[model samples]
Target: MKHLYTILFLLTGLLSATVSQTRPDKINVILMGSTHFGQEGFYKQGPSMDLFSPGRQKEIADINKQLAQYRPDMILIEREPSEQHTVDSLYNLYTSGKLQFAQLSYGRAEQYQFGYTLAKQLNLPQVYGVDFYSSLPTRLMRDGKNLDKFIEDLNKFSNLGRSFDQQLKDGQLSLKQYLLKLNAPETLQATYYNIYINPARVTDGSFGKADKTVDTARIDKSHIGAEYISLFYNRELKIYSNLLSLQQAHQSKRILLIMGQRHAAVLSKILEDNPDFNLVPLSSYLK
Candidate 1:
């Protein structure tokens, strides 16, 4: 009888542990959009801009406020994975208190400086650039290595840059828009060629030995300038899957994904197919 009682107690303990491990903790993914125009009044006077303007400071403050509220375990950016070194350098500067910004007008230097500041203030662990880098040869390949194609590519990039600049002026573009634009179909294709294909050609040392090949089938299914959209969707799904797995493994932490406004629609649709996951909108926090 004593031996039987001991065996029963051991079985009960094992059952309780198994049940605890199988249960999942709620995972929250929040996708917040930010205004890249920085804070209002960040720039003052004719054609001159202050990188550290008051408005920019305010924008950072707002972001910081949100960070405090969310206390995210990780923050992901739309940076290219190849730019990891640059990312690491920025991270070190931020965490070591060696990062600082100066007042300036017009250009990427200011924007990047500000990004560094925000990442630092939040004490973010690692910043992941989920996008691919653009390459020159890839551009040539996509455009059929012709002058006309080159010109068209240039025009597109120029136009996008202008549109984004205009949005900054109008205060209409959010951080989400700024990031998504880089991964836009045309932009993504151009970038993929630049990073992936161009390098392959360079190694072969054949700049323009043969005619550019177009995969009509792939284009048909994905469409021109939309392949990156599909890639983004795919990546998001993988991220979601990883989050789910993590939840199951720990059964104690929740996940929140901060994504662009464009993703909200598709992500919601995708989640519908996956019954195990739940999709909650930012609106939940708004009210």
Candidate 2:
């Protein structure tokens, strides 16, 4: 009887431990893909109007109020991890009412326009920069060896949403509407294909042998295009790694990531496959 009682006590303890270890909820992450409100980088030809204009500001604020419903524990932006100190410093200044929105150099950028605004509205500690940047050996494609074909391959991947950009430029679609179109599932999937997938199709590396100018050391002889896109793939992988580290450190259950529409599309696919993260669709909160 004494031995049986001891065995029962152990079994009850094991059951309790199992219950404690079972997690009912996965971490919620909103991978928001956004255009550069600053009209910078590859989007230098973005909408002509100013983001700080009264109309645009109101649209952005509305988006923020909607997102605030998610009550994110952390806001992640497209800045480099190395820039975390700078991000924290700037956020502190903004939160303390010391940094005017107009004073920041990248103030018009989405990091400030959407990210900082939401963080301040929610009174969160600080925003995080989880971006990773690496230059591609694009020169491999520009070596005049099948350059025409390379250009053709790239032109095949033209933006499907150019009309939306035009509408935004012509004042037809409001900022919110334009963003919703951009984040729509079809749009993101198309973005992933255009920006990441299409590039890999440029696999003809036969130019290496004919073009004496080509640096054989760096260029992949048979898979030049795939090699070129690998850098982009690496950067995304690094950014995902940074998010994992941050999640572990903060033990955050809800995270909001603000990134370029391209990154958003790619990271969304990745986060969807990740077991620990519940990648919440933007339509859930944004709408």
Candidate 3:
């Protein structure tokens, strides 16, 4: 009888492990590209511009149609984790019908801010932000006071130059085109690597003991291609880690992530490396 009891316990442990390893129903993700809903140039926009332009409204409707079909268990956004309170407040305002604007302003702040509202409307779980925000002190440390001043000055200049609608439209530019327009040379790649890796080491006070044998010289190029590539790679790793955690926590539920278009390629590549995840692009539903 004791021997039989031991056998039963072993079988139970094995069954639990098997259940943990099993995949959920289906995880669907969408990497959406915004176009300011066909708004004008970027330099002239104000805070009061329409949030959901007509084109954007149609897009959201179409996406909603997809959501209804997919019926995902959760929706995740690309917002900073620290902005949860602001997002929650905005969502409340939206669902309460207190947030109103033109019909065509669907992609505006008011519109983008409606992500939580949409999640609620779909009757899905609360939306989550998968990224972290840098604190003010950290930002100041990473970027000098001059850099902060420059960003402030740039924002002021931009606001004075163009309509808010235009600014939204500008954000729609593809990653490649945007980088090229910035005139970032290949050499900037090394600079970015140093910035990213050195900070962690410095902050941890482990710079003296960290591995310095690997030569990053070859990867540092002037077109800044390496930097761009690294950024995307890091982003993919972050998403993968989060998805893995979500998978472990909710063994039976599906998770849907909404991110920018630039991340699609890198994420697709990363997914290819992990056989457990079956990734389905949003484009598949459009047809």
Candidate 4:
């Protein structure tokens, strides 16, 4: 009886140890959605607010000052992982005073304006790029379905976004105000709907055909929108995975993600459901 009792106690201790090792510590995360500040033609189609303007510069400086409160151990950006070397090199130059905003062609970008700026302020080593890109469907299939109404509705939503960007460009809204508005719960929800749900409603289920050869047998009529939007889902999944990989390798306690507000909105939802992360509200620090 004594021998059996000793073995049971040893087994219980080993099991508890194993369980503790398998569960990762929760990471504090901040998903900061940003407007692309680069030149219009660069990255994607959106507003290109000039970051060099005296007014805009002051606004950004203040915004940076506000975000500094978070004191994240790791800063991540929307650039692809393959560009890690480029990010590392640029960050090194910035930290060493070898690189200046005037010297960079894409310096207006959030990667530089936000990510690089904040990392330098905190005196961190380097910023990480965890973005993953997959091509969106080239052609949307309606199969004789009239999408005029849907297109109109989508246009209305798109115009709303454009108008919001226009507000900052016209100086009607300051950069900090713009960011605050963008990060609001209602705005994030709307962005999520516009990017995913609204488009997924397309009934045609016809997107991303390699050529014009349509085989009726392979058509997925009931899931066209879901299938089409899966490209975006796949991209976000890989991005989230990359973040996890970074956390595992670095064991950072707090992380800040700087990306387009749309990506931020989508990623916030993803992080909210993840047990390993405690997603902090951007508004908490923005204010």
Candidate 5:
């Protein structure tokens, strides 16, 4: 009986230890969008705010402070995995308090203005690069055909950007408010629908020839715009794959993702369907 009692005690201890090692809860991901540093790519124009201006710099500083409260275990950015070395080398300089920004990396120059500030403030590990690049298989503007129409439709969609800029000018929305709005559920939905999915309907005249699907709509040979849409969707998938790899490798409990506003909606949709993540709204932290 003494031996039996000792064995039971050891078994109980093993069970308790096993329970303690159970996997953590879903990761809380905050996907935020940013305007680039050069402002060249923003609607073929420049950023509304002057990044170097003292007033604008102060605004960015305050926004980074608020975001640091999320306490993310990992931060992801719009960069390529191959550039990880550059990201690490640059991040090291900022964390050591040696400098304010790193010259390496690309895309909208957010690393200096937005990323470095958040990483330093939170004392986070170096940001991960998850951007994937590829050429579009189908161009919206063909040599002749609906090329002119493409411009008209594209401009109509670009109006969304102008509308957002006007809101900022009116002072009805602060910088943080505008940033949060970029990723709001409804806003993302509208952006994707109007920007990608809707324009894809333009039937680049290859509906039957290019479409992966075989339907009466494509029974007649036409330049289906689906091919172009696929390029957009495929690129996002590759980027998301990089992020997934990082999450698993680090066993991250939370991730703060920063990317272009155009990408926020598509990425949010992908993450929304994944059971492993709890898509925390920007409002939770922005407010």
Candidate 6:
């Protein structure tokens, strides 16, 4: 009888393990990278697109129509995690029709246009704020003209991105083609890594004792460049962490996250790392 009981216990343990492995806790995640509108002064530049224009609004409506088929259970917006309560209140007001979406200023690009609209269309209960804000001090390790050079390099990169977008607007490339091109490793290096990351390492004196002339820019530890890069990733990590914090409660559900276009690569990588969460391709919905 004792042996029989032991065998039953062993079988139960195996069954439990199997259940844990096979449970439908795997979440379906779709991440959308969008350019913000109506915040020109914040970027110290002109708007990327006129989201409020009739043509743009019609385009956005069409995009939302495509996105609605995913029928996500929750939508995440580009809002500071600390502002969750405020977002909750706003969402409730919007749902209750007490507040018009047009009156909302914060996260108007993401929350109003994409998130709230998606939520309302799907009858979702809530919208999530998953963004993390952190500013890490960056300085030139070598005191020289490097500071001015770095600023100039950053401005150049901004212009490059604008030019790339203009090409799309001019019908030189389809939206999918543009996104595919932008997400390419070469393109990421040309746009993001070259300007924001590489310049700092080259000028920060933390290029380490290695050959500073190395053309391929990569992150090295214990340097100012490394410091800036860490903060950049740290924010993404925090955003993913915030997403995970909400996952168990919304398991086996479809979630859509809206964030800045520049962050899509890092956030996509982070979400893809989770064994249980399947990161859905943006291409699938863009069609």
Q: Model 5 scores what on Cα lDDT? A: 0.68
Task: Give lDDT tens digits, candidate 2, residues 1-287.
Answer: 99999999999999866433332388888888987777554235543456877778888899999999889989999989899999999999999989987786567888998899999999999899999865443334544345566566445534455677777878888888888888999888877775577656665553333233334577674676676566567778899999999999999988999998878888988887898878777777776
**All candidates: CA RMSD (Å):** 13.7, 9.4, 14.8, 9.9, 10.4, 11.1
Q: Estimate each model's TM-score.
A: 0.45, 0.80, 0.49, 0.81, 0.75, 0.70
lDDT of 6 by residue, 185-236 (tens): 5554554564356655443344323233232255443355554556567777
Q: In candidate 4, where is summed lDDT lowest over 10 consecutive residues?
A: 207-216
Global fold similarity of model 5 (TM-score): 0.75
Tell me the tens digit of each residue's lDDT in model 4 across 7-51: 999999998765432223668888888877776553244333677
lDDT of 5 at 78: 78
TM-score of 1: 0.45
Rank order (by lDDT, best first):
2, 4, 5, 6, 3, 1
Candidate 4's TM-score: 0.81
The Cα RMSD in angstroms, rounded to one decimal, for candidate 6 relative to the true structure is: 11.1
Q: Which ranges of candidate 1 are over 4 A from the true structure?
A: 1-24, 33-52, 101-119, 132-214, 221-280, 283-287
The order by descending TM-score is: 4, 2, 5, 6, 3, 1
Clashing pairs for predicted structure model 5, backbone only: 36-108, 37-108, 205-222, 205-223, 206-222, 206-223, 206-224, 207-222, 207-223, 207-224
Candidate 2 backbone overlaps, count? 0
lDDT scores of the candidates, listed in order:
0.44, 0.77, 0.45, 0.77, 0.68, 0.66
The parts of candidate 4 lying over 4 Å away from their true place are 1-25, 41-48, 137-146, 208-222
Give the residue spans of candidate 2 off by over 4 A. 1-24, 40-48, 136-140, 143-153, 156-161, 206-216
Q: Over 4 Å off in model 6, which ranges? A: 1-25, 41-48, 106-108, 136-157, 168-222
